[model samples]
Target: MASLSQLIAKPATFSVSTPRTSSGQYRPRRATVQCASSRGGERSEPDAPKHQDRRDPRRARRQCHRHPDVRASRRRRPRRDARRLLLRRRGPSAERQRATCCPPPSSAPAVDFTPPDAASLPLRTRPAAHSVTADYVAKFNAGIAAMKALPPDDPRSFSAQASVHCAYCDGSYSPEGFPGVELQVHNSWLFFPFHRCYLYFFERILGSLVGDPSFAMPFWNWDAPDGMRLPAMYADQSSQLYDPRRDGRHGTPKLIDLDYSGTEPRFTDKQQVDHNLRVMYRQMVSLSPTPSLFFGSAYRAGDDPNQGPGPLENVPHGPVHVWCGDPKQPAREDMGNFYSAGNDPLFYAHHANIDRMWSVWKGIDARRHTDLTDPDWLDASFLFYDETPQLVRIRVRDVLDTGSLRYQYQDVPLPWTAARPTVTRRADSLLAPAAQAAAAAARKAGDFPITLDEATSVTVKRPVAGKRSKAEKASEEEVLVIDGIEVDRDVAAKFDVFVNAEDHGAVGSGGRELAGSFVNVPHRHGHGRGRGRGHGKNGGGIKTKLRLALNEQLEDLKAEDDESVVVTLVPRQGKGKVKIGGVKIELMH
Candidate 1:
């Protein structure tokens, strides 16, 4: 082999030729270098003759490009001394063009984010909408009026605040570095914390307008039977809280359907109340038993938005939005759709109750049902203009504590906690042996990636049962995962999910067959007038997954030892708009 010193002295030579393009721009051409000897025992390259056209600019350029020594010598040249010469040779315009073409990709706008510290402000108690006093209603109305009076351009104005909500929920903005992917706060772990931060700033803005530092907002206590109807305050047409773009039939004195599916139920007042309580019970307790089951699927940076929604966000949460929205309008404007939801003054109260549920969920099972500890969940941040009209970036971690935010929901009776769904029917009793055998055959024959134009069912195989401790089986749950859900982003769609059910239509929360649902409130693509709300372009399709905890259901169905479970999907709204990719069951740790 050649000595190291000799190899260094006679380094391999190469050249990158700059070919002229049709646009009169020089493009660098790929150059190849070869060793002097293939075996590398000794390698050498002849030096160029020193007398051969040394002053010719083209020859000098080729020589410089070909040799490493020339490049080193160029860097060693004093920059200050050669600055004028290089500038004169290239011309300022050429240099500018080069810099422009090679501009740094890191120039994305720096977010002016500041995580807030523990608040020292006096705790503000948010009153329930139905229970608020006459004075409280007057103050809240005044605040809303003042906000509406502000110019649309003002960040603290009601319209601007509505726009903020629209932009985040709808596919208006993308995450940093992900210019094409939407920044959706719904349908994932971000749902709770993002709204908490949003409400915190909004409440602050409202209080500032009303000149009450300790002023708190009201929560629509729709979970309770007495507060199931639209709050009387929002029903008053003359009040600032009223929004014309709502279901006219679903006004005060008409109870809101917690699991509304666009069709009005024939249930009387008492029946509706009982049904609504069961829905709350199912979504909060039965369906959501673990942190992952409650918070939703993980969505990290660069990941596509709308990974999935938790049980609460799927049912009463989505159903309530659709119930309040005007059905006559295209895409269910105002309360029914994401972009126009914030336009309704009741949106805040509705969300306040939703936010309260986050706290309530933690209280239900302090050991298991807790906030997700994922760092991505904690660090996920959003930008919002505060009461001062200053852009402030808030993280999920900052709003996890309502006390730190200096606000608390009024202590009220949780009637749904006692309304836990009891097993009223069993699959074996409802499904005859023949029907059960037919279901198994259908699951075996059913194809993957089925369209949801009508009722669909496919039996998916569960994980093979292994030897596990009794404690392990009790703590760990089996989760049914419906993966690769593709749907149009602009449509309001819903489909109820059932596991091991004989008839999906007949099953309700009373049966173990009824698992949960997946729903979407239509949202416009960009900030344009499109399908759902505002003048926005249509959005690209959404691909997401749905997860349901099925431990209790498996026991009720007596399918703990069974290898496969029949999964049924019944389309209640927006049929032919959704596609299911596949289904499987996994063990939830």
Candidate 2:
């Protein structure tokens, strides 16, 4: 890492292409972004491949995944004509070019960004999707219909807005200073703020189009029992809100399973609902008690993207995406994959709830569960064209408050607060008497950075006693760091983390040892863009980290007084493809 002084001294310049029309053709004028570089060291560009595969139209189609009308456009063109059209447009050397989802640059000159004063904005209330009246639904449908009616060239159009998510998520653009390093918002601390800003502008555009400045989008409140099923408004085929690309099996009357991972559970509807409430309790309370545990690991300039996702992002967030997507489509076309998630009308409503979680998190503990104060996190910025079609730059600091943005969620019942998980048995009984006697010593002596060919476990030392006050120990969280994870991006991988649990320790009713899970729903990536610590063929994998807090879990396991606890890594999805670098416990005071 470079020093703060050295990072501040370097000027960072990013090349921005001209705005593009509906046909994905660039305009004449170009825009450039200039800012103080925060990267510590210079990173060389990735090495080019020796061969290029340009003959296949399937390869080319994957590159254009960001366009919302891609599937429709493909259906319109004949098979032979589509191939010829692609070849004619791309030329022979097109294989060498990198696929990108970068949105059109601003037509105007770039300027330093500053957030508007909070007092200047009027308050607006966002309603729950299930509770909205017919009038509100009609207005929202009209707003979406209006956006879709606009030409794709317009920045405020539905197609352009959807592409914004793809550009930021799918390695389309690089940070201002880091040339080859991709700027991704998903697996880092940038996830919450980035999405907040995106939805803010999107809501504003919809409001302007409908001639209702106070128009607020509805949030799919899937967290509660009554709001568990897909919102009724979105399921109506006659409405513009309906999308045919969703999973047909997950339609209305089917309760959403928060812990869904491709495989369906045989639990009854009541059981599923109860399970979802417990899932919410574990994710929002037990698993995530700190900002770092909730928002995820930090990703600085020049760092590889997908560092790791927070507890909530790894579970219900990821699972909900996979559940809604059509299972038949390759890469689960609409809501499942990152590239095309925004194409579905349900995507915005789904994210509106995610954005709502940010507020609910703060209300849980106003003082302790506040926003991050890191300078790198606060200064990170993005470019977006507002409702007026004027390009404006916004930073993380600009969106720290819902009041400042002039929006508040409709108050609802939080039944999950009382659903905290319980441990039925003792941890020592999970292992044999002899194994328990030597567990700590054997764990301490064992080597780390092991490959996950099978279920792996390690013993991690707890915080030293007498080093801190009792009050500090009670307030501060104990975080488990599973650093330097390497895995293939093409593989559907998932693994659950458990504390002090052996194979025999698993509870039959409710998973007592289960802490949380890390899941990666497979998505297609362009050739030659894969670069990381993994040794996959064609350099196709990612290197990241995962963190989980143990403040409440330790107490449940009756391991708070113990000096060490056995940490287990159970591979539920991709077994041999995962590799873990090391594990340790740190007291975050």
The TM-score leader among the candidates is 2
Would you give me the overall lDDT of model 1? 0.65
Cα lDDT, all candidates? 0.65, 0.66
Worst 10-residue lDDT window for candidate 2 reads: 69-78
lDDT of 1 by residue, 204-239 (tens): 899999989789999999999888999999989899
Report how far residue 34 has shifted in candidate 2, in Å.
13
Instruction: Give per-candidate clash totals.
Output: 6, 1
Cα-based TM-score, every candidate:
0.77, 0.80
RMSD of each: 16.6, 10.8
Q: Which regions of candidate 2 are displaced past 4 Å? A: 1-100, 110-121, 175-179, 426-453, 463-470, 502-505, 508-510, 523-528, 531-535
Number of the top candidate by lDDT?
A: 2
Tally clashes: model 2: 1
lDDT of 1 at 17: 18
